[model samples]
Target: MTLFDSERPYKYIMDTSSILSQKPGETHTRLVYKSQWERIEEYMRSHSIVTCSEIFEEIKDKEIKEWIFSQQCTVLEIDDDIQNNVRKIVTENPKMIEFTGKSGTSSGDAFLIATAMKYGLIIITEENKDKQMKIPQISKKYGITSVNITSLCEMEQWKF
Candidate 1:
C-alpha cells in the first residue's frame, strides 16, 4: 500500500531548517529496504508541502534541492502581501531582530512565517520551540500554528 492519496486536507509550509533536518530521506541514513523507501516516498507525495521563494533560496544543498523537487514541494511565489506581512512583524517586534539579519541570521524566517500567514498554511520547522526570536516564538505571538517534523509524522500516524 502507498500513502499518496491526494485527498488530504492539510498543506504544510516547510522552513529551511526542516529541509536541513530531514536530509535526503527520513530512512535513507539508515538501511531502508526498497519497499520502505517506496512507501515513504508515497507518503511524501500524499500531501502538499510548500515554501516561499526566499526559503527555497536559503537551501544550498543540491541533494536536498533534488529531493525537494522529487517530493513535488510547491515553491510559492512571493508578492507584496507576503513581503509586507514580514515587514510588519519585524517592525512591530524589534526583539525579533534575530529574524531580521540580527547577527547575520537570514530574514528567511520572517519570510517563511509571513508566507504561512498569507496562505493559511501550517508551518513545519525544526527550530527550538523555546528559543526567543525564533520561528516558534514569533509564530505563537501571531497565532500561527507551528510544528516540527516529528509532530507531522505523528499527526499522520506515520511510524516512519
Candidate 2:
C-alpha cells in the first residue's frame, strides 16, 4: 500500500523483460528475481518496485500479473510529463525507429526512459547498453540510471 512514499530513497521501475525473464521456478543465488514466488513479492513490496501501465500490459504471466496487480507495486499512468520526455528521447535517438512496432508506433524504450527520467525512478530493463538507442544508452543521455534485472538485484542486495 506504500508504493509511492516520498520518504523512500528511490523508486525501482521495471520493464517487460524483467517480468518475462524472472518468473516462478527460476534459480539464482545472488539475485532474487529467480527466487521463490513469495520472496519475490516480498522483495518488490519492500523495495517499492514501480512500473508503468505499458510495461505491465507486456507481462504475460498470469501469476506475475496477478501478484503485481495485488501487491503494493505502483503502476503509474503515462502522464504529460512522461509523454514530453519520451518525445525528447525519441527525437534524439533516431535509431530507435527500427525497434518500434510494425506500424512504427510507440516503443517501450521511450516510455520506460521517460517514466524513469520524469519521476527519478531507477529503471530496470534487460536491454543492453550498447544496443542502438536502448534504454541503458538513452538513460545515460537523460542522466537517468538504468539497470538490468540482475544488476537491480545487486543494487538491492538480494541474496539467498
Badly placed stretches (over 4 Å) of model 1 are 1-10, 24-47, 98-104
Clashes of each: 0, 0
- Work out the TM-score per prediction: 0.77, 0.76
The TM-score that candidate 2 achieves is 0.76
lDDT of 1 by residue, 68-140 (tens): 7897766887899888998888997766655444443767888888888877778988888998878988888
| Highest lDDT against the true fold, candidate | 1
Model 1 worst lDDT window (10 residues): 27-36
Per-residue lDDT of 67 in model 1: 83
Show the colliding residue pairs in model 2.
Answer: none
Residue lDDT tens for model 2, 3-97: 66457644778877666565444433224533543555665777567788877876667877987878677778898988998888878887775
Clashes of 2: 0
The global C-alpha lDDT for each of the candidates, from Candidate 1 onward, is: 0.73, 0.71
Please report the TM-score between candidate 1 and the true structure: 0.77
